[model samples]
Target: MFNSIGIPGLIIILVIILILFGPSKLPKLGRSIGESMKNFKDSTKDIMDDDEINQDEKATKENK
Candidate 1:
């Protein structure tokens, strides 16, 4: 669904953001957003791993 942005559109969006929040808070905002996304990814991976372990245990029990 996400079409790529043209160069002009990208520049305009960046300019608008710079005008609104300025450069100072932008890095901090980006860092927090990146960290939040990373944490979400890690948690999802942990859940998938747990599911795999549970399935393996069930298979082992059924084989006995």
Candidate 2:
């Protein structure tokens, strides 16, 4: 979807965000975005680990 936007479009979007939020709030906004991404990653990792464990248990039961 963003492939067509290219550099100029991305720059324009950033400028609009800056104008709306201002420079002062950008850092906080960036930090919050980063933290939310981290939390999402962690939760996904946990879910994947649980799935792996469940598959391993099923395989073991089938072998028995």
Candidate 3:
């Protein structure tokens, strides 16, 4: 279903975002989104790291 969105759909979305945010605000918005994504990913990685899984043990379990 997602793959069905082609160039036209992308163009429409781009136009909408441009109209809503305007050209001047686009870069600022992009940076904010990037920072938010980075923070989210960083926090997620920290939580996942706390689980402290061993790669070798996981591989052996998967092999079983």
Best by lDDT: 2
Model 1 root-mean-square deviation: 1.8
RMSD of each: 1.8, 1.2, 5.3
Off by over 4 Å in 2: none
Which residues of candidate 1, in runs, are more than 4 Å off? 1-3
Model 1 worst lDDT run, 10 consecutive residues: 1-10
Error of 1 at 27 (Å): 1.2
Against the reference, the lDDT scores of all candidates come to: 0.93, 0.99, 0.91
Q: lDDT tens digits, residues 16-64, model 1?
A: 9899988999999899999999999999999999999999999999999
Indicate the residue-level lDDT of 28 in model 1. Answer: 92
How many pairs collide in each candidate, listed in order? 0, 0, 0
Q: After superposition, how far is residue 12 of candidate 3 from its true place, in Å?
A: 0.2
- Candidate 2's displacement at residue 26, Å, is 0.0
Candidate 3 residues 1-64, lDDT tens each? 6589988999999999999999999999999999999999999998778665666678889999
Error of 3 at 24 (Å): 0.1
